[model samples]
Target: MKKVALLVIVTFSVITTYGSIKSYNNLNISSGTMIAILIMIISLSIFLTLIIDRKTLKKRYIEKENELKHLNTELEETNIELESSYKKIEKLNSSILKILELSSFFSAPKLMERDFEKKVLDLALEIIEPAENGAIYLFDENNNAKMVFAKGYDYEKINELNLKKNDLIIPEKAEIIKDIHKINKNKMSPKKFAAFIKLGGNLKETLITPISFNNELFGIITLDIENNSPLKNYEDYHTKIMDYFGKTFAGFLKMLNFIKQEGKFHKDIALTLVKTLEYYDNYTRGHSERVANWASLIAEKMNLDKRKIEQIYWAGILHDIGKIFVPQSILNKAGKLSPEEFEKIKLHPTKGEELLKKVDGMEEISKIIRHHHERYDGKGYPDGLRGKNIPIESRILAVVDSFDAMISERPYKRSLTKDEAIYQLKRMTMKQFDGEVVRTFIDIIDNFNIK
Candidate 1:
């Protein structure tokens, strides 16, 4: 920019000098030497102006370049900071997925506080990294929240505090906190919840985040740090980071609620289906529920995961769904079944599997239902999957199904005693059923005092 300015100024100076010399020569004056000196003076003046303009332009260009460089440096720093923040968010997202997976355990009819606390705290700590103290409080039906788990705190003293339901008592000052309750009541803008922390008789900062699910506040996750600084202090992007964490936690809780509702819905539908099947066939009255209970017990004895146990329970409840398609005469026949009638009965497992496969998310349970009739020696119907090729769940279901059949009253035979049922199971081990699964079944029956 400076070089262009200098060139323009030099060209103008040369043109002006030439014009002045030409005018002096055309005047033909006696004072030729004076006119020549006058031209020299004019040329010098133009040269000085050009030099001054060049200096000014150089100064401006240097200032502009320096300003642009500073801006580029700041932009680069910002981009790096944004990239780091994004990576942190991604890590937080992965942690939330783990929390969701853990929360699936609570989808059962009963929520075990011990298990819930252990899993919740583990995930919470990972999300809120660098926190020295934390606690997870659960909301009870009476609208009160109680601490179920605490880390890095004196349990006895904290328990003595007895934080009430929706109660916001600051431990250090005994001042009743107010924002949390207002937020719960108002449903307006976000409210900040804070408390004073006391460490060695000195006041510090304490913060609590309220956990909410489905528009109902569950409990607070409390944190205490050493200094009196605001919770929003320490990290420059603390507000944004905390907000992201809170939203993620909320999403996880929502997903947990959804899963729980889904599981219950499925259970209800399965039970209803069992009841319907019972209504249709007197011989199989109460058979589905019994099978479900036995299957669940067998699954537990086999040390199956909660998900598998749940699948087994549902499969047991709906195992006879295919019986709905069978004719009433054949199902209630009082004599030995003809080969054709028996073949029809054998199709129930496959029919049930086909019906359940239409519903989404029931693939595992449906597969178990379909394969429950399979023999360990690869002689079963639908699919003759040999040992180990069958799903372990299906194997467990096979034991429970046969046991229920033996012990339940039928048209052609009477029910067996509990001991007789166990004896029969032991008699068929390996040849007709998985041996280890049968043992597990026996153990469960013994331990639970099942009659």
Candidate 2:
């Protein structure tokens, strides 16, 4: 820009000097007019140079403004990305915390516990509108939305007040349609026996998010506010976010339930195996039931924890599974077994353990079966350890097993009287049964229903 200005100035100066000399020496025009003409030409050159400089200045100003605007746009975009990333980190941290909470109830949350639905609904409330009211409804086979979990305001409270679990006509705002996220609660909607949830008010804002997995609708969740609620508006983005999370949670629920279903399926298989015992020997079948039931009563009477009681119950039922491996001839033998046959009968416990160890989640049950025959005084077999060396469940099982065998009729003799069976158990307590377990068994047997 400076170089162009300088060149114009030098050329105009040279022309003015030459024109002055011409008028003074040889030209016909007056020196004054020639001077005016030279001045005018110089003025015109100065004006044109000023114009070019102004154009260059204007161009630079416009270019600078454009560059600043571009930078501003980039900054805005970067801010958006940073905000998005921060939210993702926060959400991930929250999910990890929730998973940790779930781990307390389930070793691995393969099935969704009831609290999971509430947690998800809480998140939905936070994302869209944090109302105190919310609920999760699962679709039954008939496609009716059945309320499984309820929050601030739901059918549960009605039943808590001695009302029906649900009103005959549920409020429109409380109901949810399958496969859509929507909200249309208003003053015009009618009210009903409204579960005493909101103190007393009408629906303010309601949002329902459908939980879908693999393009199939699983359930819906609804959150609403009472009249005079805080929020006045809802946004589309909130629905999108709720829908996305709803879908994610639904998939987790489905996957976990599958694990539960599989576990139940395994239990059915175990029971079927038990049924095979009945086919071969009704005495053993009936004996197994009585023992299982009586063992559960003893465990409960002993004030054992829930898990221990459950262990004893399942262990008692499956204890005789090893007997399946014993030859049917020996299992149903009408007379006392020969020594060789007795040894073969003793093998049943080990056989049961070996077969059942292959089943998932039944390791403890198998071990209990293996040790159920172990005597409290260390005379038991398969792996005889001393008193208190046997698994507690097995010790409990020994007393229950003996009591049931005595009270139940066998092919060899008529069953003992209940009182007589009690006397035998008490007589054998220290040597054949764990003393404490026997006492607990005695204490609870009368309360137990045998039939």
TM-score of each: 0.62, 0.62
Q: Which ten residues in a row have the lowest lDDT in candidate 2?
A: 179-188
- Candidate 2: stretches off by over 4 Å: 1-95, 103-129, 156-210, 213-216, 225-227, 231-252, 302-311, 386-389, 449-451
Q: Where does model 1 exceed 4 Å of error?
A: 1-114, 126-130, 137-148, 152-203, 207-220, 226-233, 414-423, 447-451
Error of 2 at 77 (Å): 19
Q: Supply the global lDDT for candidate 2.
A: 0.70
Model 1 lDDT, residue 297, Cα: 80
What's the distance in Å from true for residue 101, model 2?
Answer: 1.9
lDDT to native, each model: 0.68, 0.70
Q: Which digits, one per residue and each the tens of the lDDT, describe model 1 over residues 4-115?
A: 6655766776677557766877676546765676677667666777887888889999999999999999999999999998977776677666655655654543352346
Tens digits of per-residue lDDT for model 2, 1-451: 5747676676868686766678677556777977787777777777777877898889999999999999999999999999987876666566555534544534333233446666666656665544557777776556555566777654554334432222222332223332121122221123323334343246665666767678766676766665565555444444555555666666766766677787689779878988988887667767777788888878887788666777678788788888878889888887888999999989988998998889887888899999999998889988887798898889988888888888777787788887898889888888888999987877776686653
- Candidate with maximal lDDT: 2
